[model samples]
Target: MAVSARRGAPLTLEEISSVALRLIDEGGMEGLSMRKLAAELNVNPMSLYHHVASKEALIGLICATAAHHVQLPPDDGSPWQEQLRELALAYYRHVRAHQSLWTYLQNHPEAVADRQMSIWQALYRILRLAGVPESELRRTSDVLHAFVTGFVVAETRGHLPDDPDEISRDFDTAIRLIIHGLAGFSS
Candidate 1:
């Protein structure tokens, strides 16, 4: 259904984010502008400001909304390594599903720098379960985050094979290395 702010009804942030995400998914961040979003929602360009202060804020809103959609692994008695692997794979799928948004986020560090992001928080929990010291949490998370994201970045940029099975094997190996490396921190 088409959303419209034309019938004396207000546009919800969810509506704005949904339409904005569709736009980014269609043409990437470059194609997303207040004017374009307004046109998509059938609202005045200035009306967007009521829900989001600026384009940056709108992107941030979308990021947060999308982040919530990522399925973090369940905390049931599963080993942390397994849970971590699940989390990594889920995140990988999310990135692949939203390549354009992920690319935009990769370019704009501030957009994904929120410490409260679901992915970051999930990683931190898994790392702590893996026995990383509190003092080393941030550093450790950064290293692991860089490793996985770097691999995805390379793959998305065509540095890796295009075969899905090959890519899955490569990512599986990477995750194993990460899990093995974490074993050293085991007390």
Candidate 2:
């Protein structure tokens, strides 16, 4: 069944965010236009503006919301390796699921400071747990984050070839290799 929007009432911020997110999910960031969003919501484009300040702000909110979807596991009982793996897989799935978002996220310089701190912090913790020196933790986290995010961005743009199981398997291999290498460095 299709839903229609009324011209009388404007969409809420959440509603606008949902519609925008859906648009990005369906098409890349370029696919998310105010007119397209309004059409999807079955409302006048002007009404959307009432809720979202502008297209840029709307995109920012969507990025923030997606960033919130990231989950970090408890550190007490779980091994750092397991936690990092889960986080990486979660990040991978998120990127694949919202490939459009990756396009916007990559180009936005403020993205790291603005909405992606949770992801960076988690990776930072994992690197620290690996006994990596504190001086290098931030730098290491940046490198590791870039590695995965770059992979996602390339994949999203179709720059990277698609292989059904390749992402997870290759990531798993890479993480294991890195951890093994870290162990040697520690010892």
Candidate 3:
């Protein structure tokens, strides 16, 4: 929709997020500013403030919106290793699909806590199920998260081959190794 079309309509948080995400996609984080977003939305710059308190708040909203797409594995009777693999792959696909959002999150780790909590919880649960001690839960979760994030970032940046089949194989292999290592921590 053109900016003029939205001139008089009340702006929704969803719209703001959509446009903001688009801006980031098109021009990276530097491209997203209150003025640009307002211009894109056909509203005054101040109007954006009505929906999002500040640029940082808008980034948080965008990250949360993107995080909504990263589904966690089901809590059924699946093996903990399998569950961890599914969660990591799901997270990898989501981050790979939204590279800009991933980069933004990487640069601003503080902005993603609210949205990242669910994913962390799922990982933590799987680790706990695998017999990870309470003393090592946080460390284990961080290690798993670091591996997934680092691998996906590298793969998306073409440091890894562009072949999906190859990437999938590599990802599974790495996940299995990580899972196996975690198994050592089980009581």
Candidate 4:
């Protein structure tokens, strides 16, 4: 059995977030609770309150942490289409890896409304490269985000074919369609 935290040791938000994220990953959002987190940490439930105000707040913290883990393609002057494909694939993998959290995020737009998020920034950059005007940047990115997210959601929910190779081929086709569609945009 793992040893509990010593009475003198103070719990950190990192520790709390780590354990909470693990709980979320293992059992989805429904499985995580302050009590469960405390039990996992070997601390009093009240101790969690010292780090996060409530379950919602803790979830928010966990989401932010998860967002940071998403691998965004660097602005390496690559072709916009390639960059966009990389971005889409990275985002897809990230969300699929955390499906429960993605479901929560879909239901709660505010959770992902931060335009400064790297995912948003990467999308906006790719849109600009694709010649999307500043005025249309938000709208264009929103559409693309929706498309990729919706695709992965469907794939994860068993709505798509079961073969991994078939899924990849379908996704590539989808990306080509998106890029071809974006070709019509003008600055």
How does each model score on TM-score?
Answer: 0.93, 0.78, 0.85, 0.89
The lowest-lDDT stretch of 10 consecutive residues in candidate 3 is 1-10
Angstrom error of the Cα, residue 148, model 1: value is 1.0
Q: Which ten residues in a row have the lowest lDDT in candidate 2?
A: 1-10
Ranking of candidates on TM-score, top first:
1, 4, 3, 2
**Runs in model 3 lying further than 4 Å from the true structure:** 1-8
In order, what lDDT does every prediction score? 0.89, 0.73, 0.82, 0.83
Candidate 3 residue-wise lDDT, 1-187, digit = tens = 2233458678888888888888988888889899999989888798777777889999988877766667889999899988988898888888766678778788778988762467777887898999998898888777777888788878878898889899998898889889888889774
* Candidate number that wins on lDDT, 1 or 2: 1
How many pairs in model 2 have backbone atoms within 3 A of each other, for residues 3 or more apart or on separate chains, i.e. clashes?
0
Sort the candidates on lDDT, descending order: 1, 4, 3, 2
lDDT of 2 by residue, 36-92 (tens): 988887887777666667888887778767777777665775777788788888888
Q: Whole-model lDDT for model 3 versus the true structure?
A: 0.82
Q: Clash number for every model? A: 0, 0, 0, 0
lDDT of 1 at 94: 89
> Which residue segments of model 2 deviate by more than 4 Å?
1-10, 153-161, 182-187
The per-prediction CA RMSD against the true structure, in angstroms, equals 2.5, 4.2, 3.2, 3.2
Which lDDT value does model 3 have at 92? Answer: 82
Q: What lDDT would candidate 1 get against the real structure? A: 0.89
